[model samples]
Target: MSGLADQGMLDLGPESLEYRMIGPRPDQAPTLVMLHEGLGCVGMWGDFPDRLAAATGCGVFVYSRKGYGKSSKATLPRPLHYMHDEARESLPRLLDAIGFQRGILVGHSDGASIAAIYAGSHQDHRVRGLVLIAPHFICEDVTAESIAQAHDAYDNGDLRARLQKYHADVDNAFRGWADVWLGNDFRQWDISEELAYIRVPILIVQGEDDQYGTVRQIEIAQEECYCPVDVALLPGVKHNPAREAPEVTLRHVSDFVTRILQGHEAAASAA
Candidate 1:
């Protein structure tokens, strides 16, 4: 598969972030901004963004946060509120830099939390909706355990070798995310209250067997958010729905994007 046709690094003063844009005439459609997993980077997303663009007829924008992928190296011991920082600070700048007029945030794992935070905190009208895959509204024991297992995998398994292919500073990428999640202070990290403030439609997709978080995360969004919420719990899938269940994930996301765009068009016409 061909890589993103338009790709580059953006200098955001203190740090530089790598980004990729996809789809035919990206400016024409609503942009789907993809936020990768905790240890993920632009390269790790592979062809998923392209697939999403093809399926939804929407522009796809993906970027690597500082310290991941080919982006600038980050300082060690990431703050407990790193996701918060991304949502509150970095995301807005990136969107402005990209000239994003219409957008839907599609985030996975750690990325999902950032998306939810951005939606709730910024309340940016340009962001029409959200697609959260295996998001963590509140920290859980399972999440900590899963991070511990990941640490073990990086130490004793082939996980590091695999991840090295995508990250420039592999240790920074792993330790940066692991250190924060495993920290005692991070246990209380919760974004449930933030969800209540999100006004746009949201789609929550999680695997039934996901080891990191349970359906409670979804329940929190459903219970808290006043806006419409759609969910899909894949029977045999795991945390990475895009990879674990591509077809199903694509169909649901594409359909959701279409509906959102259609509604936007209808509203414009009504006005």
Candidate 2:
């Protein structure tokens, strides 16, 4: 693979993150910047980014955060406000580094929260929309319990071995996510306020049977986001909707992207 369909390390001074570009580069077309789940890395996304790019005819950019995949190790005992800092500090640098011209922020789980915060905090006109999959806007009992179970699995079961295939530092990747959500300080971790300030449209794709979060998450987006908030709650599905049910998830995301981009194009022509 060469040209736009290549993988490389992106240097951001403090960190050198791993990333993949699918289909067109950001300069050539609208882009889809995918943010992975809590225990997810660029590699864990598998070929979903490729499928998305093919379906939408947009550039797809996916990257591992500092601690996940082959990226740099995270600072030990990650700060309680790590997600906030990521949205406010790290994400902006990444967008600027990539020369993100116009695109939708496609995020899953923890990635979805960061995308919400970024969209709310920055009025970057280049960001046209958001496609949030299995996003959690607020803490819940189910979330804590699920995370605790995940930790147990990692320690006592084959979960660690499974994750090792993707992360260079598996412990760092799991610890950074597990410690935060399972920590007492995370109980009130809510980004509902951030959703309110988002200026663009949002498509919240969730699973009805998601083990990590509840329907309240979707409700939170509906209540807090002032902009148009579309939803797709898939029956008999789980937390990882895109991977668990690619056909449905991809259709929702692609249609959302197409609709929003077309609207933006029309608006631009009129302006």
Candidate 3:
């Protein structure tokens, strides 16, 4: 495992990843390995990571996966199970390489789905809990419709220009995510079974009026997960909770992490 102070590009075999680390390292404190949305990169997270680190006193490791941000370009026409591929393959390497000890997998949107897959697919006791913001467990009709609209926006609106600021190759970042989800085959995409296998607790924060998905996503997690499930359905909020309701998101995430990991720290010290 590499040192937490390690900066610049992360070596992940054929493709290196761009990353930013904040606050204490893993050895000093529990870490929060943040996974961005399908179209998001390390830059898009902005100052949220900084606030989270200050609030929780934990390190925050944010990175852009392949095909997004400044990272290497992904091959075109990505496989239907691209999220699965990332969960089982790339994510594990990232955690081990960074010397991740104990912490939660904090994810937003697609990042949340990937986190669910990784936790359920393995028995990693180090992953103490999960903080999922706008996670999708199954593909909904609304999801497809919203993605179709996004295609139009990307082509015609200022969305492309806005995205270009954060992504090195905007089309690759957008198309890699948009194409797979828009495919007819993706309609049947579901990862609910993975939830049942997750042994750690979970905290799901979703927008009540999310255009991309409905509360059914939350229902799936509630129905399938055996671990303790906490839900925060924010009223008048949209897909991106952190952006739309930063303070609320910060409070929920920081409190949950403190309750889980900080409490654990106290108990361990007592023992």
Candidate 4:
């Protein structure tokens, strides 16, 4: 954990994203690229990345997206295509800059959706698998309701104060995500089509009691994706699986990562 926290920041020209590297060297094994949630940042992830690294013996790289954490402030009123732009533009650049050759994307919430978009859109062979935590394939009524509740909590409750600990501009982080989701135009926002093109194996982790999304999200992935898909529905958990059910989530993710790495190694050796 100490070593993981000691990692430095990455300057991606226009926006300097803060990042931490954990576990083994990038050259020694496959990497786990973690993408935080909408209102999440590098610091917000806490020791989950460290625990994951320890469990899998894989290098883990966690980064805060633009306008979050120590990254540069984002332009006001983010477009409807902000997530798409991240998948199509910023993510690729970040991967290249880090020299990511072989890896799995471990993403949560908004970050999970971005990972799905990237896997479907890009035929990058380096990406061997995906670990989607609390992913949303399409906009749902519950999503809007929960976000609206969050908006109120941010305004009148302690949610903003808690989030401020992680985000440099807490308002930007929360509003950018909440505004887009709560907007009428966002009702049509769906990435199910993206699932059809993803060639790698996938592992979906969802809390049965999640307020932000439902089992429909996982069902859509099962129905659309051609690749093998695994699921873990935790009973007493909510939106944040990594936080609420760390041990179980860690075991599932670590097993999936190990299997993929082992398979890749076997294939390479045979060739």
TM-score of each: 0.96, 0.97, 0.97, 0.97
The clash numbers for all candidates, in the given order, read 0, 0, 0, 0
Runs off by more than 4 Å, candidate 2? 1-5
TM-score of 2: 0.97
Compared with the true structure, the alpha-carbon lDDT of candidate 4 equals 0.91
TM-score of 3: 0.97
Q: Clashes in model 1: which pairs?
A: none
The residue-by-residue lDDT of candidate 2 on 103-163, one tens digit each, is 9999999999999999999999999999999998999999999999999999999999999
Model 2 has an lDDT value of 0.92
Where does model 4 exceed 4 Å of error? Answer: 1-6
Give the Å error, residue 130, model 2: 0.5
The model with the greater lDDT, 1 or 2, is 2
For lDDT, the strongest prediction is 3
lDDT of 3 by residue, 80-141 (tens): 99999999999999999999999999999999999999999999989999999999999999
Model 1 clash tally?
Answer: 0
Window of ten residues with lowest summed lDDT in model 2: 1-10
